[model samples]
Target: MNNSNQTLTIKEQLQACRSKEETFKTLVTLSKILQRLSSEEKTDENKVKGCESAVWLIVEESNGIRHFNADSDAKLMRGVLVAILSLVEGKAAKDIQQMNLKVELAELNLSSYLTSSRTNGVLAILSQLQQP
Candidate 1:
């Protein structure tokens, strides 16, 4: 288990999981965190396209740093969003724009467990975050 006081980088957190079961557990934990940030009000304007499930993303900028809030109709998709958010949330817009989310995700080794559409959904969320 990760220490509450010690913030781990996304790569470090993902690497901490040694097995598929552990990875799934980590995703579930991330999904729970996302669930707390989600709300029913984020329906129409914030909805993300290209996802098989209904996913909503709300980005709030404070002092040049972006805070991400999101939700999904599907648990797995929510988990995926959580993974994406962990890397980008609280980052500067410029940092978000410069990030190679595809490469970061590849390092997480999620492709083996996720379907093509699910992978695309994650990419779609990353695309949204990259917008100016």
Candidate 2:
């Protein structure tokens, strides 16, 4: 399954994974998707701090659109990155600034599985996006 059909939101994707094994599949699928980004697009400017593994992101702000390019080494961490993408992708930076990832994660029921450090990493990515 190519999981790239933008028809389903990341939250919806996570919701579709009702079992532990299914969730693991979702994580692996996300990692596969993110790995498509090129090396130059990956940088410290894009890195997410505090994660249990490496995750980098490039937030493209162009003509009022926010596009996210991200990658992660940890499979479970990839799901965490997707959680962040769920909130801000396709929005303007102004709209992204208004987003509270904490609330979004809570709504998605992701906190139960993610570690505190991993949660901080997601928040850090959003904080990086908040930069001018």
Candidate 3:
């Protein structure tokens, strides 16, 4: 699904969560929906810096749309990556460039639940994805 619809679905699901543990469980479920990266795709070039856990992101563009595949050694980080990537995967580059991931994460109430370092790591991934 495209970002707008997928984002709403994520929001609704997260909003329905009653507690942090429940929220995390929901996130883990979302992570399961993401495709895992192949060993060949887990090179230095794809590695996301600043993360405490090893994380990789593979980006591909076609016909002006960007596609992202990501993975992380930590299960929670995997879910976090999926949550962040769902906003931009399969989206047009122009549209993605217009997005503010910080604000998006705030709207989702995710950043407040993460540690400062983890939030920084998330921002690091956002920085790479938003580069011109």
Best by TM-score: 3
lDDT of each model, Cα atoms only?
Answer: 0.74, 0.68, 0.81
Give the better candidate number (1 or 2) by TM-score: 1
lDDT of 1 by residue, 1-132 (tens): 112222255457767888888778777766776644446556678988888788888888889988877888877677767677777767789998998988877777566557888767777888999998
Candidate 3 runs further than 4 Å off = 1-5
How would you encode candidate 3's per-residue C-alpha lDDT over 73-99 as one tens digit per residue?
988888887778877878888788899
Clashing pairs in 2: 46-57
Looking at model 2, report the run of 10 residues with the lowest lDDT sum: 1-10
Model 2: CA > 4 A from native: 1-8
Q: What's the TM for model 1? A: 0.83
Among these predictions, the greatest lDDT belongs to 3
**Candidate 2 versus the native: TM-score?**
0.79
Give the C-alpha miss distance for residue 36 in model 1, angstroms: 4.1
TM-score per candidate: 0.83, 0.79, 0.91
